[model samples]
Target: MMNIMRNSKHPVRTAAKEASHERIVSAAARAIRRSGYDGTGVADIMKEAGLTHGAFYAHFASREAMLAEAAERACTESAAIAAEAAASVPREQALTYMLHAYLSRENLEQVERGCPLAALGSETARQTPEVRRANTRYIKEMVDLVARQSPDWGQAGAHERALVTVATMVGTLLLARVVDEPALSDSLREAALKHLPIA
Candidate 1:
């Protein structure tokens, strides 16, 4: 009788715990992006999630564990944005739509909630293996999504073209953020949009 009672209550406890865990991860995701991965503090994440810092151990094993999960979540979000844009446009026009959206001033202005690769790529080299692996998986997924929308999907250079596009977009966005002058930043974005070898 006691065993049956305990088993019945297990699910409710598990669901509540999972919900709390998600909240922590989500908070970590935004925090890391807004304040670089190395800058994100544990106390800030828990406070953002409306939980005590002491509660962090319940959701994540350690700081690195939270970072890996947060990085994964951020990168997944960036890929999803590109994927959705690709799906909405005609096959031949998909790449154009993606380029427009990715290079837009709006995306550049929204650093906290924008592309993780643009925000964290340079820093990830110094991160743990788990964080690096999560970043690699998401980057591959992004490249694959771009390749699917390529005009030369089955051609000799389709995959390479897609890789170049990803690198250019990320590099351009990074440059856009670093320059002090608005004109220079706009120029970088415009030049890429104008000259990128889009097929």
Candidate 2:
């Protein structure tokens, strides 16, 4: 028997739908960072994507599904940015460059475009498992990235050192963003940047 549905698939329509899906995910990614998961609504995401609210169902099964994808997108972006920052310097200085960039004033104020872990880590803990899974996957990738930049990349304690480095960076940024006092925020980030055991 012939498969009618398979035969009816249109490449152009598929491409267009894929583009729309990208737009929706991108918008949701920014929204989640800007507004947090609980604050991001379907209607706003759709509107930001320039999509009709009715078109959301054609892409995702539920809000949580979309949020999961969005979280993944944001994390991927954060990893890429960190990689770029590290790549711009020498091998020995890669970790230092990345640390400086992450703890910089520019990243501090760019919540919507900053690292998702620092921006949404606390909120993610209370989110659905699917969303947490997405974040966890990227968090592991980031830890590996830091480990690779270490002088003892393949050594025993490299992974543990990377874990502590990531934790400190995220914690520093999180607290920097939490305090209303600009001086305190600057101090928190500066202190972390100074004391981070980069190699």
lDDT of 2 by residue, 114-193 (tens): 99988886899998898899889888988998999988898868999899999999999999999999999999998998
lDDT on C-alpha atoms for all candidate structures: 0.87, 0.92
lDDT of 1 at 48: 86
Q: Give the TM-score of candidate 1.
A: 0.94
- Show pairs that collide, candidate 2: none
Q: What is the alpha-carbon lDDT for the whole of candidate 2?
A: 0.92
| Colliding pairs, model 1 | none
